[model samples]
Target: MTPPRLTPVAERAVLVEFGTVVDAAVHAAVLALDRALGADPVPGQVEVVPAMVNLLVVFDPLVTDHAAVRAALASRLADLVPEAGQGAVHEVPVCYDGAFGRDLAAVAAQAGCSVEAVIAAHLAGEYHVAMYGFAPGYAYLTGVPEPIRLPRKPAPVRGVPAGSVIIAAGQCLVTTLTMPTGWWVIGRSPTPILTGDPARPFLFAVGDRVRFRRVGVDALAGTQSGALPAPGGA
Candidate 1:
């Protein structure tokens, strides 16, 4: 099959369109192309950012034009190879009690389910790390079942603590920093997704599988508000 359509986005970036929907196939294509680019470096390439259904490839215009980049990408995409066992599965521990999950009640009401049911659904989801964006180590995850997909908050909440598990845009994310967000707050995780170390700055990568685990409010009682543990443990 032909690869995603590549279109110029500004003077130095190109957007590769996989489709107008979020799914594993679309993400796979994006990852495949990204991997191919990394294996065979793109001339003048600055960075490549993956999204739900697209890949934003930025290059240095001084070294190459959009046409050249597009042609090179086309060649690369044509030879794209799928990755086997592409990403790791991380089980994120989330405290879903009322104190941590502000929108939990509302989400339950919207889905015609009880709070326990909402928690169950969220935990039952088998999600994929679609891409990382919006902030450092902020991983946008796919596979949040539609019933729990609520719209972003009417206004952004200020100072949402790190490790917050929020959902919106038909997906979810584990916050890596204490920052404002418009997404619906659902839970909190103590597992830090970001690290200062250069070798493993981010815990999850594009295509990583994420499963949510329900942690009790007591588990978060003694924890500091924003102090997060590295990548695992409840």
Candidate 2:
């Protein structure tokens, strides 16, 4: 495994930065370290949070100092291997037409392609859940094909409906709640990304692969998008 740069988050916690850019290998390393820490923990480890290309390890300062934390991380990663660890695969249905995707036309114009082409590109690429943030169950996904990648809008939109799937910064996201955003609102997902249920709060997890499946508005009727059909599966 590639070594991570050990940075201090304070006197206690440590941020294990794996890479400067978001990459598949970096994501794998992040998750690998996360699993290892949970499976065979270091002393005073308070929490192990995974991000796009790094892991935030919060430990109890009283029990373990910075040096000890660093040493534990190094020891744990010494023989570590990047993993794909039984993560789930999700085929989320999306509504890309009409008001649900107000920015579809804009994205198509920016990409210099037809609306159909933009949707096709999104559906074609298999995305990885790099991390979740900005809100509960709100995931930041990578693997937006380079050809269609766009920057966040110069100005942010006030609020988008929950289930909106926006794209920007070479990534895609499914909104967990009604919130304002700078990313282009390309579509709306049929499934709710966040939930109050304790059993399954988020539909996806880091390392899980997802492919967006275009769906008609009728399909979303009466179906709770976040409604789990089954407990767990890829």
Candidate 3:
């Protein structure tokens, strides 16, 4: 299905929805628009965020009015070509033992599988970074297998530690900061993407493909010098 017509998201932003549903075609279109905005930022463009199936264009009201910016974006939307979801595949190492994977047993039980089966299912799936939100450098990934589509906790935890790998509603998320989340926590990774530095903050971009590899806790805490590759999904 084609995306819905462009609409005003806010006073200074427009939401270009590719479709109401989450699918490969919609996701690719959103990424293409996001790439186009990045490659050739419009005069009034301030930020372009790629969500699950929508592209949000934030504009500078002082430089150009909202209507003008929206018109400009709408004009260029016709030139977009579906990206085919092509991108580098990053491998994110995760430690799934002890405190890192306190919820692993629980998740496995819910899935009616062993802990090993849970780990295998999560690691083997090819997931796409659908959107980056809910926190700094926190990526909402798609392609969680059917077996692991457990609902979030009835009550969210007061604080979930950083680097926690969580799953809910067929999506996966990695926490870069300690935040309350209703999703089930499966594991943790120390080399999380979001850094505190404003200068070098988020590492992953929208449309980046990611895969999780189960590793020992000691390996995760040890020096990552050349141990793990960069996050570009190579």
Candidate 4:
């Protein structure tokens, strides 16, 4: 495998880039480097943030310069191993009826299938938490089934409710805050995915797996206010 290119970011961070393709292999490599750094950090390393295809290593400028940090990373990269174990699998309960799934019929029409088929294809997918962005506690999940995959809408929809399960560009995400989105809102999950506590703010993390379980709208009533139960490993 080709080694990732390291670029200095400002004066306090270094970016380790593993190409620009957003696929599983590149993401695994990024995670491997992140794991290695967490186990044995370079001098002055403060935080390592993983994204789709790169890692940002932040360090204190006072303790070490960029050269020393880069050298330390080079040594560690020579023997980096990708993480092996599976992350926790969260089963999210979603209601796909009526108002909860405003875009289901549209998605079905676009996919050349029935509305039920659209929901079925979505539930069949085993999604992976690729990264977190856009908002706090909001995770970008990959692995949407090919049949139901579609690009983002040309225009953004305003005031999409929190907990809306939206999909676009072969990825899925649950809205953590009330905001506008161009993705198709296929369903809604009543479970609260964001914990307000400072110690643990989000329910899901990068590399975690997520599966959707279908439920009626009645099941969602009065269940949207508490933290989700701890996820279990697959």
Highest lDDT among the candidates is held by which one?
4
lDDT of 1 by residue, 1-234 (tens): 345888898899999998777666777888988888877878999999878778999999999989999999989987877674578989888997655787788888988999888888888898888888877888888878878878787899787778789988678888878788898778887777875668997888787898988887667655544464332322
Worst 10 residues of 1 by lDDT: 225-234
lDDT of 3 by residue, 100-182 (tens): 67678889999999998998899888898889886668889999999877988899875677677889978998887677888
Cα lDDT tens digits for candidate 4, 103-130: 9999999999999999999999999888
lDDT of each prediction vs. the true structure? 0.81, 0.82, 0.78, 0.85
> Model 1, clash count?
0
- The clash tally of candidate 4 reads 0
TM-score of each: 0.86, 0.90, 0.88, 0.91
RMSD of model 3 against the true structure:
5.3
Estimate the TM-score for candidate 1. Answer: 0.86
Between candidates 2 and 4, the lDDT winner: 4
- Greater-lDDT candidate between 1 and 4: 4
Q: Model 3 — which ten-residue stretch has the worst lDDT?
A: 225-234
Q: Model 2: per-residue lDDT, tens digit, 1-234?
A: 355899998777899988888777888889888878989999999988899878899999888888999998999989787767457889988988777778888988999999999999999988888888777788888889876899999989875777778999678998877778899988777677765578987888777889999998676566665431221111
